[model samples]
Target chain A: MSEDRIDIGGIADEYVLGLLDAIEARQVETDMESDPDLKAAIAASRDRFLPLDDTAEPTVIGDDLWTRIDAALPVQGAAPIDVSRLTANDNRPGGWRATALAAMAAAVILAVALSVNLMRTIEPLVVAVLVNEAGDIQAIVEDFGNEKAAVRLLADFTVPQGKTIEVWTLPSPERGPVSLGLIDDARSVRLDGPALPKPHDSQLYELTLEQAGGSPTGRPTGLILAKGFAKITR
Target chain B: MVTGAAPDDLTTALAACAKGDRTALRGIFDREAGRLVTIAERIVRRRDLAEEVVQESFIRIWTQAHQYQPDRGSARGWIYAIVRNRALNLLRDSKREYTVEDVELLRERDQVDHVMAAWHRLDRTSRLHDCLGALDDTKRRGILMAYIGGYSHGEIAGRLSIPLGTTKSWIRRGLSALRECMA
Candidate 1:
């Protein structure tokens, strides 16, 4: 390998080893976005030192700690929905109610389709109902074992002029978001999962409106239209 | 090292967590919280703050479970990495004033004798124990102090009475050697 590659790998090693100071660590994280090689090197280094995690002595924790953490979690059902409050005293005839009724009908059809699809697959599979801010299902991601996955859009979405929708996943917060690919159409699209890591439940799948081709910065650079967490269906 | 959740189990639980399964999150907490608390306490040196770190780290783990990649590393490592980073950030951000005596005490407590005792307790057949055994005392101790104790280069240098540059090189080279040996 070239000296330049070795140098990058060495720095990645230090970063993974926690030898880098805060400033250097932050720089590596920024570089990782625009630099795939750097990201791979860091991943390799992380794997190298993984065994070291065994060295820490197991300590007992206070019984209340788990409760405290559980209490602080964002309610899973906290998806943006204000229709309930609005429905309470709406004298207006069929305003939000009409839209909501249509949405619910769509959801029921999608659920039935999903259940049928789930029955056909023998392998352990995970799925995510990607929802917009208003809690409308925009897309559904079905991940089969290994790195194979498919994304199906549930609602009609027109990519704004001079823009395209891109898919991204957050594997871990520290690692930041990794681009999955650009969505060409809203129908069922096969995701290039092998190029990315395996999909895990609670993993987030999001669609962001980016420049026509994609985000030039390698990170999401536009408004996130929809996001949701994957869950195991098996 | 003895792990509560096997790698596959941890990975499965994390996946379930991503699916918003509180049961899966509870499973992980039940299995790993004790060890995580210990790891954080070692770095932060306070039980209460360490517990807080565990709390925050678990929440992150629950919220971000989908992000764990088996290809990158073991699920246990990924989980512990979050806890360690959170504790280290808290310690560094707070800029806790450590008296000279406290530093000396930590250094003394992390001496080779103590570290070796911990190392020997690990399964002797494990690759980590064998590879770590191959390193010279200074290199081994330097790496261990950084990972387990969360000691910065400056602190490691102070403890070892070595120049900062030498200490840095030792750790960097030590890790490189470990990578090669483990591979």
Candidate 2:
């Protein structure tokens, strides 16, 4: 770590504070990213200043705050951006933005539809929900590696900040929900069961939002988000 | 819905946003808005302009979320860079050139900024006040301006009415001193 022997500790401090010129600043950023030891040192120095940014404690983002933010946010799922705000400034050439966004949205929608459609058609391993009046949804999974099948469902509720939703595969109608790892929005984690259970009625794939990181006690702390029947649509 | 993408799931979530997952996009916003807004406010120092920066950052994130790769820095760092760059440009554009009066105002504002900044989680300075108190007045001020306010060497020189080279050395030595003392 002779490369780390430079007594330029002061320069690292200056760099973190944005005291360096653009060139020097970029150089430091590059070094920080490329050099792990240097990065660790800078982080140690920078930690001294962390409290400066910690003014707002992790306050419970109000329920209403989410609503307000949601109202202000762009609509989801390939929805075309509503760029009505830019139009009022008829002074500058802002029309290009909306046009560009519309083009992008069009492209993405085409991609998603293709993916969703293909997934449906291929029907690799299918699962369907048979939800009923009692608010129960049984997950019918089909075609795992062999005759085995796995069932999974994402809960349709808040997972709370720093928490994950666990999808449980109940062995029998009266049995407890089996553990399926935490659900992150990264990708749908489809939990596979052992051998295919006799495809019967009322086999549920349920999800409950648990506490920070996840339910420590192996149970739901937040609330049930989604419950669906594993109706494997071949 | 969130506006910005999550750090760990940037690429996937960005892909999802492109796929029209409004909820996914909103998830990004809900996570990082507060930090981004603070960065914007620090750069612009004006509410409306900071808002403009935040709005622009959101729009840019909406479009560029697709290009974000996990191998790069981080979702948070990337979004912050975008927001900070926007805020800086906006600050530069509005011709808010720091004048003598602005300097005085900035100095007065530093106390409150210093107080509130210490409350933040950025970790620029931890136990800094104690380290600062240990230093001489000149060295303490140097650390304060550089770390607390993110001031450039030239600006610090101008504020203290000292030669640029001298200010630079002070900052360099002061940081070293603080490190030694803290260690």
Candidate 3:
């Protein structure tokens, strides 16, 4: 917890006010992808300044504008893969319906565990039920929103001679996938990962098979053995 | 004239967008486009460019609707953020070609008037209106120009004919003060 300190100066305010230079502003956007406090600060500032936006007169949009926009929309019904909504009744293309049931069961167990442990432990900000390609529940990830996350493996993996199971999360598009930590013995452990924006609904979490130390690129380069989206804890 | 769509309706529309409902996107457009265009036009200063910004923003909204987290903030705020960022980016990339002296002499009046109009329009009873009333004139004006006009630090300083350092401090301090007063 000693490492929880952050010093972003007042850039959040400047960022929200549109005062930072272009480069600095972009940098702040990148920083917010991994810094929850900064994200929250900027969000707060944006909300506060929102009243100013309402002052503008609502001018009529050019009639052709919507036509242009309508023409440019992505092809309908080609919805992007949204694993967060994967459920036992999903009739979507992916044959995920089978394992989704197991995933739900795992989530039910997690919910009960969460309730039973409510008064005994720090509540998680989001919980994800990781599943293998076959839809078997593989692990559970509990992100604490303090740069710390817990990985509790429900299934064993044969970590070949020099390979290890690594935990990863997609904090934002700019940050890409970040390595949370490495699991060497298939044991439950809490990983003090690098700071990240507070987990949001549908944030991706996964486990990958990687070289012993970790991916060389600081990304998930190995085979993804399990993956799921974070369901924010109530 | 629409005081923005009701928050829950907008939220529901966004959810439907996530499910690939095009009509939902249209509903949002029908409800928010007029104001979104106006908001972007203030920052970009051109109707055509502002329309372009709003158009691009809608595409993004439709594609990324699933990413909106209901618990984090209001859906209307989220949509307005998309438009504002696009408008600001367009304004920044083209660099507006205005010399500091030209900006000060020619655009200062309009910018100040723009910001002042917004401040005056704030609901008389709202905390925002009262908190802003409490700020020093310079600080309040500096904050408003940056926010309403999307002026960068240099631009705000140039528009106000103040030292760049003074403009930065005023904005930073003004925002912090505004946060405290609102709190």
Candidate 4:
């Protein structure tokens, strides 16, 4: 669709004004994914109304609020590990038995340290936030550097009587859409996909409503309920 | 808006947070939590719920910091968008009603005062101030009521004693005029 064809009858303004109901708002968001002009309009509207946000006087927050937020934060591999205890026993010297025990303990500590380093280094090669046609976030796809990817559903999706939601990714133009796996229901699950190539940034990932068994054509053959472009997660 | 921290600082802080720097997230909280709480409170109208919104918003900022595109919008705007969206969602889900209690009535009246106060606070030398100043009194009030107080169309009509359809048109035309004037 052409940008000029979009009706600019202050729909963006209504959206920013909180006048649109939940469903209408979601439809606007969904349309925005494919319409740059609409997205720009909404962004402009938000920018224009931002000054009103400043009119609010800063409300004093309870001290416990920050503590609660901190506690709820996801583990981002920055957790502190007390290494002092590991070195505390180093200064002690004894017989061969003590030396062997110390060596064993040192090995265990080294293994733990390596695993932590691995955890720090290993992250999803790319991430995608899948949104349904209504623009509501439905699921998230995380493609590891290997032939493994994880799909976590953010919202419940109703599967039809004989339909299943199949996850697909386009590794390259030559290799159209490849099936990662079939989702039985709306739940977080990992897919052991066929080895093709490493998922690149902006790679397409989608969930299509297909037959209960799976797509017979080994490609996306049904309605694409949710889709998103992958973002490189460094 | 005059942020205590510069816009560049917020952008840089977001980048740092994306790199797993917890202290950077803390820096954002220290600078913007109070104002964020206030914004959420305006929409949700409850201290505890507003605080919850801010907390959830900060968490989103932490997790989705990587998604922030510098070319798209200001970091401060992005942060405010998160807070507003969360607060709006909460308000929508709860489907709050405006009661006729004395305190409720007092708060409704204050919404008008808050909106006008914001208009008055806008820098006179700025284009936004000039554009908004150019709007009709009722039209401008309708726009402000929605943006600042998060009032729905029906609520604005009820408060302003106008028909719902009129309220919608006033706001729609008011926004269109504001955009053209600013442009």
User: Candidate 4 residues A1-234, lDDT tens each?
Assistant: 333533453887787777888778778867876876777777777777777776677877656678757765665534334222222221121111133333433333333333343346567777766765334556777788588888878678888798898999877543457899989876778889899777776676888778898988687656566766666654
**Angstrom error at residue B7, model 4:** 2.0
Instruction: Please say which candidate is ahead in DockQ: 3 or 4.
Output: 3
Off by over 4 Å in 2: A1-8, A30-34, A38-46, A56-234, B1-28, B56-126, B180-183
Per-residue accuracy of model 1 over A1-234 as CA lDDT, tens digit each: 677777887888777666787778778867876887887787777655555556566676645567567755655435445434332312112212223334444564465467457446544366666776445778876666465567777788877688888887765443456777778655567666435556665565677777788778777756666766666564
- How far residue A31's Cα lies from its native spot in candidate 4, in Å, is 2.4
What digit string (tens of lDDT, one per residue) describes model 3 on residues B18-79? 88888999999998899889888778765655776787688778866887775436788778
lDDT of 3 by residue, A111-192 (tens): 4485345334788888888886457778888888899888888888878898888999877543457889999887878899
- After best superposition, candidate 3 residue B56: deviation in angstroms? 0.7
Could you give candidate 4's fraction of true interface contacts?
Answer: 0.47
Best by lDDT: 3
TM-score of each: 0.58, 0.42, 0.58, 0.58
DockQ of model 4, rounded to 2 decimals: 0.18
Q: Which CAPRI category fits model 2?
A: incorrect
Model 3 chain A is weakest, by summed lDDT over 10 consecutive residues, at: A86-95
* iRMSD computed for candidate 2: 16.0
Q: Candidate 3 versus the native: TM-score?
A: 0.58
The ten-residue window of minimal lDDT in model 2 chain A covers A87-96
